[model samples]
Target: MPERGARDLSPGTQARFDRFSPTGPKTSLLTVPGAVGAEVAGFTPVGDVMGCVVHQVGYTETSTWSADRIGQLADILRAGYQTALDRLVEEATAIGAHGVLGIDFTITSPDGLVQEFVALGTAVRATAGPRPRRPFTTGLPGQDVAKLMLAGWVPVRVAVGISGRAFTDRWGRPMVNEWVGNIEVPMATELATAVRTAARAEFTREIGDCGADGGIVSDLKFDLWPVHDVAVAAMATVIGTAITRFREGPVAPTSTLKILPLTRI
Candidate 1:
């Protein structure tokens, strides 16, 4: 077995041995605060859990588009995210954890050739009994999960939708030269709509694969920047925590209405 500790992949005999060990990193079973830490209703935290993946970005043409994939940036992003998510689940399961709460995801490029993605959270167990078919993953805090549980919802997994897109200008189109008069540049509008639709569909498909009803989608994030002065490329990201209905249970007093409304609409 490997000794669990801070894994820096450092240069030393002990580090080398720990890397090969079957066990996960040994983190102090202490309390975590903020979004990554929570005080839920029905679950207890065991320890801090983490899963890290360093992937070498596969080859992609910088110029032309490939109908199979590179043409669709969302596909490439999905592949990377899926692999990282799988690793995170594996670590939690290894420690016999029921689920992970308030999972925080981070990504960074090490050298422009490889990218590193990390998912970290607190591993917890149900206070009642064993977990469902498998441990669940959620981006929500522990308190939220507890409230959700009371409302008959269980988080299935953390889900995301991402898109990388660019559009080419069709010079001949009269709309392109809106300066001539007053006209709408339908090209940008159409391309933007198409790209966003595609990304959303891909995200829904992923959540479905987790064998759940649906997920709670947070605000969609967008990073739209210009690619030169001619074309535009945008990255749209949506982060959410997938959830499904558990048996109906009692809600907390806070879950109920506090004050009665004076009038009804």
Candidate 2:
């Protein structure tokens, strides 16, 4: 047997131990953002985040159902709707949003087992300040100046997809086509919801990391594609500019700001 010492161990054993142990210097836990830091500091906010939830329910058809069973069908529909809404609300609460806006719900069920449901909307903090109004100068000619007005932000593209078992029709007929057309509406809505959620999370993370209040989302677009015959994928991108505003007491002569026009003649 080899002599045992505090600093002496088998190379393989040491390596394995090191691999299993957490590595790197321990960092300050208070530096973590969101609730992590709050927990460490033993502080809690006065109110909960405000947010909205949207729910979509897909159609379901059963041969056993008759005109007499319309009440049962309605009950089933209500249950599905509530489930989707609850899910959306849960997600928004997790992210600490103050409230949700424009909650939209859609449902489409071409087949019984493949019901599609979607809920979406904006999540915002009730305490957050209103967006500042910035006057944009339009250099249109006098002849066209009267008709020109600032247009609200618009998303350039939106796309969504889902992947899973193949969908069937209301009559329990499996769709032979690789693509199901009836699902487009609900799928798209849900895709938009997910994309927007991701985008907002990213924006919030960036704001916290950079010590900024908030940023605007513009030129947003969404894309959806099929990963498999049954699996779908969706993405949203915001390519516009983000501006950070600071309180009035800044005196930095060396700081340079750049502004670009959206259009040029």
Tens digit per residue, CA lDDT, model 1, 50-154: 666667666655544423223454555666667766666666665556888877777789687777777777766677854665678887776677678768878
TM-score of each: 0.71, 0.26
> lDDT value for candidate 1?
0.65
Q: How does each model score on lDDT?
A: 0.65, 0.35
What TM-score number comes out for model 2? 0.26
Angstrom error at residue 104, model 1: 1.2
Q: State each candidate's clash count.
A: 2, 20
Error of 1 at 192 (Å): 2.9
Q: Give the Å error, residue 79, model 2.
A: 0.8
